[model samples]
Target chain A: MKRILLTLAVAGVLSSCGNNDTSKQAADQTETAHNATEHEEHGDHDGHGDHVASSVSGNTSVNGPVRKSDQASAILDGYLAMKDALASDNSAKAAASGEMMVKAFASFDRASLDPKQQASYDDTVDDAREHAEHIGTNSGKIDHQREHFDVLSKDMTDLIAVVGSDRTLYQDYCPMYNNKKGANWLSTSKEIKNPYMGSKMSTCGSMKTEIVPQ
Target chain B: MRWLKIAAVATVVVLVGIQWIPTPLNRGDTRADKDFIALYAPPARTGTLLKTACYDCHSNHTDYPWYSRFQPVAMFLGNHIEEGKKDLNLSEFGDYSPRRQRSKLKAMSSQIEDGAMPLTSYRLIHWNANLSKADEKAVLGWLKSEIK
Candidate 1:
């Protein structure tokens, strides 16, 4: 009878702990939703210099120095240009942007990165350059270009994860692409202008996460 | 003792009854023209390894074990294969654009090198699905040659 009572006491404690965990998880989710709303508000307030300045300073307080590199910024700019071209369904412009990105990647200063970052960047760039070249050569084949762009977006995401970004970027995902395997792309704006679907389904995706400068 | 006997019989009856609930099978009658093996034409050993390790999920045809016909397990395996094929249907490799093909090849090589394929959960049951050290070398070497 005493042993039975002990087991009941232990069970009560374990169940209570489980309840606490679930409540904590619920609170964390609410906090995350609050932060997402704040990010949306920040997007609306973009280009307002005072707002931008205050947010940058606020972020700096949480994170360390903002990672800034002219070469990385140039590569990011070229990538964004290509994204915009694809979103606009302009194959030739996308090809030109792809060529520009290949050059940007070629001239990227690796000396600025640490050894681990350099290794990851090198692996990513090799595949990225191949994708860019495919896009650059297949100017008229928009479908083929979109396929390449789909994979190239992954490489860009990987590159940014290692090299860091100069400005805030949004990672958007389209669930209907590639036979429902889904695909993701980075954008400078919060708006969903899906490059994968172009005008057919321009607003098909939603922002999954925001990458702020750190 | 009577209650224990009744409970045991009830469990057995429930188990047998559940087996009648059918699950969708991934087996296909014919090989696709764009099949990965047909397109790439890897060596015999590499081909066999891929079939054993990947085709069970990533291709249209799965070599179902006899036990896989049972309940709950069948549903679980069906869901797994569906998710896997969505990510990569190797049977339709030839249908992908050249750039997408290149990207997929690169991903395959990296996944193999990282020991992330033939997923750990899968290897636990399908003993032959585990890629040995030499298997990894052969697969990666073949993938590298094809990535270009």
Candidate 2:
């Protein structure tokens, strides 16, 4: 009986170690979901940046990355898909996703946006659309497509800065890209799996910052 | 003591076995026009100094040392080059935007002055990689004059 108990104890310890890693991964996913839901519910408000309503009084953590409309969310889905395709180094898939992004950008009616956000949205969408088209058109030329992706990422960053994203995002950077010129992209995961360098330098970057919705 | 002998033998065997495993070599012939010296045009002497001290880790091509032929050492050197190039790649420096070029030059200068670069650990193996105080000062001076 003692030997059986000892064996069980060892098994339990080993299993617990496995559970620890799973729990950490689960926590990260849960945080992303929690932030997404929070954005969806609170997204209707026009307060972005410094003027965010302090739900209570002194709590300013609710400041923002608030993409307040369905149009914005749809565009993000396409952008995320493109990001994943690039991460996988699938040029054709990336090009397809880029086309989807252009459609999403076009589908968004600027008139539907809150009057306060209209000017920024109009400014951001046109630039983002142009880059998306470039990325989509260059299906065979992956390197050139990636360059456009980098520029698209910058526009996306600017867009998110103004309106904010409903989903959690991380702004990642690879310093070695563009001949060590450095480039930025948005990622769903905080981990620095670079999309720019593809397989040769897949893990060659770091999270510059996070863009969780307020 | 008996267990220690067994452990030592096991370690030696593992070490020898690992030596046969090949690591990826970061050696490629990239064109000169794309290289940092050619792109930004740092002074001729300074460019040479940068190559001697920095290129092995911070460029696409690594000038591997004799020790790099061994397994564990090869892996270590490969990992270092991967990490180093992520932060700075001299071979692609010219391709950077003008703004990015200035930013990197500024960062390099600061890192040099702070003694946070050309990592001390690297200098231990390749003593020639060590930049003297005067050389460091001169590099920093050149950066100030040229970069800004």
Candidate 3:
């Protein structure tokens, strides 16, 4: 009887230890989530000299990447299809294609870009539509439409580069960086270029708000 | 038993009554546009989109939601808006000077492409602010031109 009781006590102690471990895990996960959420909520606007600016809030639990995963992706696909269709300079097809891209660009998720960068994105979307519509309706050359394509392509390229490189600016600070990969950081190997001047070392982090007023 | 019933009623009353209490509105400070203009000047379409969708939180002047007048929720909104604008303020764009503006635009484009801006939680309620494909192209296109 004594041996049996001792075995039961040991088992009970082991089970309690397991429970404790489980609770610790749960707490850690919750704390990490809480901290991340807090960072996003507060970090969106940390040090501007003006009035209090609110961070653009988002639910990080959504399905897919912070960029390519939403409804905006489908719109991009359709726009690309139209671009391809219009390549033949088929007026009718081009018009239809142009419309698709226009609608797609107009409706692209504005909420995706941060406030500081949102204005430029908006302008690009509008300009691309204007060019596409003009090229589609008129007897413009395919080269002309391709010019607009170049414009759109360039914007997309820049946007991609910024998105890829900007992980460090907000990863430790903004909640928007709460994607599955955690905050994206810069690898030391890459030469940080300045946004204003290509090939300059003025990376995005260089523009951080100044601590002292000029 | 009577005291117990009274206590239950009081608790319910407090819970129900708290919802009725009005919270302060966030009538953000908009006088800081000088800095905003200096730091960033988006091309036409992209600038418009930012003004419409992001200026509320990221700038000095937040539009404020209806429920923002309620406590707790209002507090949450206040903290968020303050934080957002601090990280990047549209109203204070001019403050950054030319070099800073260029860099800011680069950051702006990247954040948009990466789907880190308008914030999903924000879009859930403000449906009009949602960017369709065309909108994305316009904004991104403009940024590309300016950057190039």
Query: Best-fitting candidate, measured by lDDT?
Result: 1
- TM-score versus the correct structure, for each prediction: 0.46, 0.44, 0.37
Better of 1 and 2 by TM-score: 1
Candidate 3 local lDDT, B1-148, one digit each (tens): 9999999999888867776766455465556456453334666666667777788788867777777666567767777787787557777766653434544565566667768678887888788678988998898777756652
TM-score of model 1 (first chain only): 0.68
Residues A143-187, candidate 1: write the lDDT tens digits: 778777877887786677667778877766555565544566879
**iRMSD for every model:** 12.1, 12.4, 10.3
* Candidate 3 structure quality by residue, lDDT tens digits, A1-214: 0000011111221222124477744543444355445545444321121011121123321111223233344334544454444433444554566666667666767786778557655544444455456445544444344334433443332232222222221111111122321122111122222221112212321111111101
Candidates sorted by lDDT, descending order? 1, 2, 3
Number of the top candidate by DockQ?
1
- How does residue B64 of candidate 3 score in lDDT? 77
Give me the displacement of residue B82 in model 2, in angstroms: 0.3
